[model samples]
Target: MVLAFSTESLNGLCSDDQLELLDAIDHLRLQGIDHYISLPQIIVCGDQSSGKSSVLEAISGVPFPVKSNLCTCFPTELVLRRTPETGVTVSIVPDSSYNSTENGLHKFHEELDGFEGFPDLVEKAKVAMGITTLGKAFSKDRLRVEITGPDRPHLTIIDMPGLIHSETKTQSKTDVRLVRQVVRSYMKQPRSIILAVVSAKNDFANQAVLNFAREVDERGSRTMGVITKPDCLVEGSGSEKAFISLARNNQVNFDLGWHVLKNLDSETQKGSSLLNQRNVEEARFFSRGAWKELPPSMLGINELRKRLSDVLLKQIAFELPSLIREIESGLDESREKLKELGEPRRTYDEQRLQLLQVSQGFQSLVEGSVSGSYDDPFFEDAQSDKGYEQRIRSVIQNMNKEFADEITAHGHRREVGSKSQTPDQNPEYVTREVFLDHVQSMMQRTRGQELPGIFSPLVVADLFRQQSSPWEEIARGHVKKAWDSAVKFLELVIEHVADPSISNSLLEKVIRPALKTLLTDAEVKTAELLKSHHRVHPITYNQEYAETIHFPGSHSREEISNIVRSFFGLSSISNGNQYLNNNNYNLSRLVDNLSKRVEPTTERLAASEALDRMLAYYYIALKRFIDGIAIEVIEQKILVPLSDILSPVAVFKMPAKVADLIAGESWESRSKRQDLTKKIDVLREGLGTCERFVSSRLKDEQNSQQEEAAGEDLDTSDLSVGIPTASDTEEAGVV
Candidate 1:
C-alpha cells in the first residue's frame, strides 16, 4: 500500500493504529526485533534433495512423500493446530507467497516421491544439499516439493527450498527465483518464520546459506537452524571425531542463529550417536517400508524414518507462527517501502527544511563553542584523535558540573531545595565551624540526587573563570566556549559516555538551561548588591559557628564577640585606629538567617529542632534590636509628659486598660532614683498650672489660635490626651 497522501491527508486517513505501526516500523529498523520477543514463525527450510522429507516425516509422524521426485514446487503453508479428537494436525494450504506469481513455479513444492523412489531419492537429495541448490540448472518443476503431514501445536512450518546457495553445480536461476518469490510471499504474512537448514556437514560454514537467507528474511535470526545430516559422523571414520571440534566452533560462532530455537548441534544433543563402521561403508542400509514397528532411535530404515518424522514434527511446531509473523511483517514493510517510493515533492521539501534548521542550529552552536580554530593543531591532528577526545571530555566534565548543580539546586541556586537544614556548627567556634558547615552543606546538598560528585562538581570553577586574566578570557572564549554555550555540547555529552557522578536527569533538565539563567542572574545580583554595599558590608558578626551549637546563647555577648574575632582570626578595628562605629557585629540578620535556611533539609525529623533553633536566633536578635530602641524612646520621650500629669498609680487609674502600664512603674528599678520619682510627682501638679495658663493664653489669643489653625486641618487630640483632671476648670487643661 503506497501512502501517497500529503501528511495532512495521510493523517486524515491513518487511524491511530496505522500511525503507531509506522512509528513501530521506524523503531524496528533502528533497533531490530531483538528489542521484543516475537511469536515464532517456524519456516522449515531445506534443499531439493536433503532428507528434509524424512525429517518432516519423523517429526510429523505422518507419511510424507518418500520418493526423490520434486513434488513441492510452490511454497506450502501447513498450520499445525490442535483439535479434541486428533490431538494436533497440520492444516495445509499454499501461502500467498505462491499466489502472486503467475508462473508454473508458483505451485513449487509437492510431496517428492513414493516409497519405491526412496533410496535413490534420499541419496540424490543428499548430493543436492551438498552443494547449495543455487547453481543447479534444473527445470523449475524439479525444485517443487509438496507439503507433508505434520501434527503440531499452534504452529506452521513453511518447508522451503533445500540448500540453494550459489555454490551449487546444478543451480538454476528459475529455481532460486521461485524459492525467493515464496520467501518474499512469506515475508508478507508477518507470521512467516524461516528455518535455515544447516547440515552438520561441513563444520558450520553451511552458514553461508544465511547470505542468501538474508535476502529472503531480514530477521534471519528468526530462522530456526536445522542441523540435518547429523549422521555424517560415524565411528569408523576417524574424521567423525574431528567433527566434534567443528561442532564446538559452530556453537561459538553461530549462537545467535535463530529466534524460536537454539541451533541443534548434534554433538550437544543427549542420546545422539554416530553411525557404526558397517553403516558408514554401506551405500544401502537395511530397508523398511514403514516406521510403525521402529525403535525410538534408528538402527534401520523404519527407525530412521521415525527419527526424521519426530524431529521434523517438533521443528514444524516451532516454525509456524514465526513464519506467519515474518510474512505479515514483510508485507507491512513492503507497503511502507512503496509509500516511501511515492512520497510527494513537498514532503521532501519540508523534510529538507527541517534538516536545514537542525543543521543551522548545530552549526551556530559549533561555531560559537565546540569547533576548533584553524590554528589549533590539536583539533587538526591527523595522526592521533587523542587531543580531540580530550577536548570533548573536558567539555563534557564541565557541562556535567554545570547541569548537576542546577538540578541539585532545583534550577536556581538561590532557591532552597537541596540544602542542609540544621547543619552542625558551634556559634562560638565561628570561622572553621561555619566554613566546615559550608563545605559539609555543599556535600549534603549533593545527596539530594543519586549522583553526588558527578552531578555536582564544584562550579566554583566558574568564579575562577570569571576572575581570569583578559588574555585567558580571550583564550577561553576561543577554546572553551563549547562548555559554556552548553546546549549543543550538553546534548552530545549526555548521549555519549559520562562521569559516573553525572545524573541523566541533570543533563536533560538542569545544565542545559542553567548556563543562560546563571549569566542573567549574576548580572542582576551584582547590580542590586552594589546599591548598599557599604552599609551592609561594614557590619561585624557576633561569632562564627563551631561544628556544634556550643554557643546558642551558651556564651555571653562579650564571649561570643571574642569567639567571633578568634574564630575568624580577625584583628579588632582599633577604637582610635579608625572605624566609624564602636559596636561590631554589623552583618544583616537576614544573611545569617538565609544561610541557615539554605542548609540541606535534613532527612530525619530530629534535625528540625536544630533548624528551629537557628531560626529563633535570627528572630531573637532582630526582636532585641527593635525592642531596645522602643524602650529607649519610651524612657526619654513619652514618660516625662505623661508622668507630669499624674502620680504613678494615678496614671494607671486613667482607665484605658492599654495605658495601665504607662506610669513610673513601667520602668524597672524606678524606685532607685527618688529625685526622679519626686520630680515626676511634682510635675503632675505643674501640669494643672500649665493647663490654666494654656486656657488663659487661648482665651486671649483666640484670633491667634485661629491664625495658627487658619490654613491647616491637623487634630491635636494626642496633644490634649495626656493633659489632666475632671474639674470644670480642668476642661481647659484637656482642651
Candidate 2:
C-alpha cells in the first residue's frame, strides 16, 4: 500500500518544522481538546458514489473499500505522520452523544504493522459502534487511524460520510439528516479547511457539497474544490470542456482554487498495485486532454498533497494566537466551576465549615443590598429585572413611593367637597351640601343636654373613623410587598453563594421559616399603626387646626334673618329698632324670640364647623401614617432583618447535626466536582501546548530573519514562506 511518489518527494511536501506544528495540534486533539475548542484540520466532503473514497485512496495510499453503493457510514480521521517505521493504530473516539458503556464502543482499539487489516478494522469499529447488528444506520463516532511511515506526509484529513440527496429503504430520512448534520458540524468549525469533492461525471451544479461548502465558507477562503473522475467525460465534448473550465478555476472559482484528481474506475477496483497504476493512468489522461492546458500543480495528487500540507500549516499559524486565547478562557471557566462546586464535604465538621463560609458570603451580599452599598458585580446591571430585584434598598424605596401615593389618593372613605384638585370619581365621594345634611341629622339623633349652639364631640369622632377606614388595607399591603421583595433577594443571594444541594436544604430548613416570622411581625406592626388612627378619638397638637377652621364664605344679615323666620314660623318684626328698645321688650317675650331664633342658626353653624375639623385632622394623620409604615414596618421589621437571617453567627449557633443535614454534599455535586477537576487538568495541558507552539513559531521566525541577514536568501515564492505572523493576522483582520 505504498504511495507511487518517492520518499524525497514526500519529504519535500512538508518541512520538519511544519510537521512539528501539525504534531502539536494533533497531540491536543488526541487529548480531546477538540471537545472544548475547534482545531484546524482538513475535512473531505462529497456526494454519495462520487469516487470520494477512490480520491482518498490515491492521496493517502490507504485502501479504502470502493463499491457501487455507499461505503463510508461514519467519519474517519486519517492522521499521517512521518516516522522511521511503518505502523497503524486504529481506535474509536466515542461521540459525546453516547456514554462510555454504550455497547463497549470506548473499548475498541487495535494495532497493525501495515495497512492490510484496515478494512477489517473498520468493520470491527462499525460493530463496536452498534451500526452492524443494531438497526442504527449511522453513528456520530469517529474512527481515528494514526498511520506512521517514512514516506507519509505529515497531515490530518477527515473523510466524512458522503452527503445524501434522498432517503431509500436502507437509508431512512433520519440517516440523511444525521449525515448532513455530521458534515455541517465539521464544516462549521471556523478553522477547518473544506476539501469539497465533486465528480466530473455528474452535473457540477447539482452537487450538494459545493452548496454546503459555500454556506459555511461564504467567501471560499477556506474551501478548495477537488474534481474527481475527470476521465468519465468524453474528450472534446461540451461536458469535457465545461469540466476543463471548472478545473481551471473559471466556472466555480474558490479562493484556495480547484484541483483535478483522476481516481480508479470500477474495473480497476479488483486489481493490485492500484495506487501506482492509478497515478500512471491519471497522468496519461490529463496530459493529452484539454486538462493539459491547466498548470501542472493543479492537475494531480502529488501537487494536491503539497497544497493540503501548506494550507493546513498556514491555517494553524493564522489561528494559533486565537486558539491559545480560547484555551486560556476555557481553563479559567473550568477553574471557576470547580471553585463553585467547592471541596468535598464528607464529615460533619467539613460540612459545617462549608455552610459557615456560604453564610458569610450570603450575609455580605444581603447587607450590601439593604444598606444600598452596591459595589459587588452581582449588582452590576441595575436596569434588568434580576439586577433590580437584587438591590433591596432601591426596590423598597420605589415600593414606598408607590405606597405613599396610594394612601394619599385612596385613603379617605369620603371626598367631602369640590375642593379636591382631581375630584374623586369613586362611589365614596359626596358633595359639601349633601354631607352637611347627613351630619345635621346625626347631631339631632345624638343630642345631649348641651346648649343650642354646641354639638357633641362624639359626632366628629364617628366621622373621622369612617373617613380613615381605607388606611389599614393600604398599609398592610405595602408591608407585604416589602416582605416579598426581601425574601426574593435573600433567595438570590443563597443561590449565588452556595451549591444547589446546600442552598435548597438551607432555604427549606432555616431561611424560609425566619422570613415567615419576620413577615408576620411586619404585618402585625402595620395593623397596630392603623389601630391607633381607627379606634382613638381624633386629636392633634398642631396649631394648623385653628388656621384651617374658617367660615367658607361671607353671610349677609338678610340671609340669616330669612333662615331664622322660615324655621321659627314667625311673622315679620320691625326692622332693628323695635328689638333694640329694652322698655318695650318684656322678659318673657324676649326669651321666647331668642330661643326660636338661635335654634335653626345653631344647627347650621355646628355642621359647617364639624366638616372643617374633620378634613384638617384627616390630612395630619395621613402624613403621620405614611411615615410610620415606611420606617417601622417595612424598613425596620422586614428589610433590616434580612442580613441576620443567614449570617455567619447564625450558622455558628446551629447544632452540628443541623449543619450536617443542611450542608451535606449530594451525589450529583460530588460527581460534578470530579468531572470539572478532570476537565480543568486537560484544559491546563492544552494551554501549555498552545503556548509552546506559539513560542517555537516565534523563535523560528527570528531564526529565519537572522539567516536571511547572513546572506542566505529564502524562497519568498514558496507557500510556507508567507505564513502570517500574529500581528500580520490581526492587521489582515482575522478575529
Candidate 3:
C-alpha cells in the first residue's frame, strides 16, 4: 500500500533545458510557494465534456479516472517526472473539515498496479472530500497524482474543476459560482499559462473555456488553445472549415496559437492503452487528411507538450525576478507585523525592560520637540510651521499683533463725557473722548494738590487702568491656545513611543495633572505682571518711545515742535512763538490745556505712549511665555514627570494583573504573528529556490558563451540549456 518516493537520484532532473526549468519550478512549489500565492505553472481549463481530462491523460501518460462528471469535480494536479521504472502514486491534500479523520494521512499515498487503481482512487478521493453523497458537488482541494515513468514528460499541470453551465442532481445554484471561482482562481495568476481546452465536436462559440481564458488573459498572450477530438469534425463540412481556419491561425488568433489533438474515439477508448493512443494520435491524425495540412508543430499531444515545456520555461525565467521581489516584499511586511506584536512581556524583568525602553523613547521624543531637533520617524512630514515652540509662539505673536492693532485703532480714547452714551452700551469698548473725560474727572477729584501745574501720579495710574483692562482676556486666550498645542504634542510623543494602555495611563496619571498646575500658575503670573506695570506712574521708560516721535524732515527744535503741534491738530506757530513757548512761562498754558479744551489731545498722546510700551513688553513677555510652556511648563512639568511615571519602578508598583494587561498581546495580533511567521518562512524558501535556479541558468549561459569564444563546436544533441536528453532516463527518480 505504501507509495513513498523512493530514494533514487533526481540530480539529473535539471539535466535538460526544459526539464531543468520545470524541475526548478517544481522544487519551488515543494518548498511551499503556494502558501504565499500562486506560482508559475500550466493551468488546464475547459467546460464540462470539453475533452479536458483526455488531453491531461495524454500529456501525463496516466489514466486519470476520466468520466462524464466524476473526475472533473475536484482539481487534479498532475506531477509528471522522468523515471527509470514506471509507476503511479496518488495522495490527497484534504480539506480542513476532513483533517481529524485524515490525520497523519501522508500514509494514504498508494502505489497503483494498473489503470484499475485510478477508479478506486477517484472514489476514495470523493468520499474523503465529502462529495460522495450525491457526488456532483465540487471541492477546491487538490488530489495530487504523481507519475514517474520512462514515457512521461517532465511537467506539472493543474487540471482545474471543469466550468459548469447548469446545476445537476447534487449541484445547487452555488456550485456554478464555486466551480467558476475555482477555475478563475488558477487562471488569474499572472504566472499561470492557461491551457484552454475546447472540443472540436462542439460549436467553438459555445465553449466557455475561451471566454474564461479571455477574462484573465485578455490578450491571449499566455493562453494556448487546445482543440481536442479533431477527428469528430467531418472532412469537408463547415465545422471542418471553421476548425481548419482556427488551426491555421485564421479565426480567434491566439499569440501562443491553437493546437489540435486527436484522442481515442469512444469505441476504442475502453481497450486502448495510453501508449497506443499516443501512437495512433500521431499515426492516424498527423499522417493524412485536413490535419495533414496543418503545421507539424500545431498538431498532436506530443508537440503540445514540447511547446508547453518551452513556453513554461520562458515564463518561469521571465517571472523569476518578479516572483523573488514579491516574496521579499511579503517577508518585509511579515517582519514589520512581528515587530508590532513585539517581544514577550510576561515576566517582571521583561516588563521592567519594556517600560524603561518606552520611557527613554518618549523622553527623547518630547525633548526633541522642545529643542527643534526632530530625528524621530514619527515626526517626519509633520507640518513644517508647526514645531512645538513655533506653534505656541506663532499663536501668541498673532494675538499680540491683533491686540496692538485693537489698541491703536479703537482704544485711544473713551466716550465718558456724552450723557447720551453709557458704559453699559458697549462694556468692552472705549473711545478717545470717553477716556479723556474719565482722565479729566480723575484729575478734578485729586486737584487739591501741591501746585496748580503739578501732574498727579493718580491720573497716570487711572489712564493705565482703563487702557489695559482688555489685556487679561487676550492673554488668557493666548494661554489656552499654547496649552492645547502642548497637550497635542505630548499625546503625539506618547503614541509614537508607548503601547496604547501605557499612553492612556501616563496621560491620566502624570501629564494631565502637571499640565493643569502649570497652566494655572501661568495664568496667575500673567495677571500679576500686567497689574504691576499699571501700579506706578511711568516708572520705566525706554528712549525707543521718544525716538518714535521725530518727523522725517524736521531739523531744529522749532521745526520739531511744529511737527508735534501739527500732529496734535494745534494751531501753526512760527519759530519766534515756538521760542517763547519753550520758556518756563508756558507751564501755565500747558496746565490750562490739560484741565480743559486740549485734554482730549493730551489723553490721545498718553494713550498712544501706553499702547506702545504695552506692546513692547508683551512682545518680550510672549517669547518668555512660549519658552516657558514648551521648555518649562510642558517639558519640566508634564514631559519630564512622565519619565518617573513610566519608569520601571512605577510599572513594577502597578498590580501584576494590570501590568500583564498592558503588556499582553491581543488574540488577533498573536494569530497574525504566527501566520506571518509561517508565510515569511515559506516565501524565503521559495525565493532561495528561484535564486539558485536563476543563478544556475546564468552560469550555463556564460559557459556557452565561453565555449563559443574558444571556437569549440557546440553539441547539437545537447538541445537547449536546461532541456533534458533521452539518455537522462538512465538516472531514475521517484516523484
Whole-model lDDT per candidate: 0.35, 0.79, 0.63
List model 1 lDDT by residue over 1-735, tens digit each.
Answer: 111111221122223322222222222322223112233344556655444543443333333343333335434333333223322111122232333234333322223223334334433433333222444433222222222222222323445555455543444566666566554444444334455555545555455455555565564433444445545545446444443333333442332231111122223321112122223322242232121122223233233323333333333233323433443454455445433222221233433332233334333333433333323322435344433443443444454454333322221112113344433311222332343344445445544453423222232222112111122222223223432433444354333322212224334433444444543443343233322221232222445334224533332334444555565566642323222357555432322333342224333222333332333333333333223322322212221222122223332233433222221122222222332333333333333333444355346346545757787565543223211213323332234
Residue by residue across 1-735, what tens digits does model 3's lDDT show?
A: 122222221222223535666767787776667747668787889988787877766665544544545578788887776678777778876543444344554446777755456667767877776676656488877788877777455668788887888887667778988888878877898889898988888888888888888888888889999888877778889998898888776877689999988776543554324445464656576788877888888887667766876677667656666676777788898888777666766576676677667777766665555555656675655456444333333444454566445434333233222334445332344454554455556666765553544446556556556555555565566556656766776777767787665567667766677677767766665555555655544453445434543321112234445555666566753333334445533432443334332223554444443333434443343344344434443344433443354445665576756555565555665566667777888888877776676666556666777898999988745445333222221131101
Report each candidate's C-alpha RMSD, comma-separated, in the order given: 42.2, 9.3, 9.5
Model 3 TM:
0.66
Deviation from native of the Cα of residue 67 in model 3, angstroms: 6.4
Off by over 4 Å in 2: 1-12, 65-71, 82-87, 94-107, 110-117, 149-153, 203-206, 232-239, 265-274, 284-293, 321-354, 364-513, 524-641, 649-687, 707-722, 725-735
Report model 1's TM-score to 2 decimal places.
Answer: 0.25
Output the lDDT of residue 288, model 3: 89
Deviating ranges (above 4 Å) for candidate 1: 1-39, 84-152, 165-171, 180-194, 201-203, 206-208, 213-221, 234-242, 249-252, 255-735
For candidate 3, the per-residue lDDT at 560 reads 46
Instruction: Return the candidate ranking by lDDT, descending.
Output: 2, 3, 1
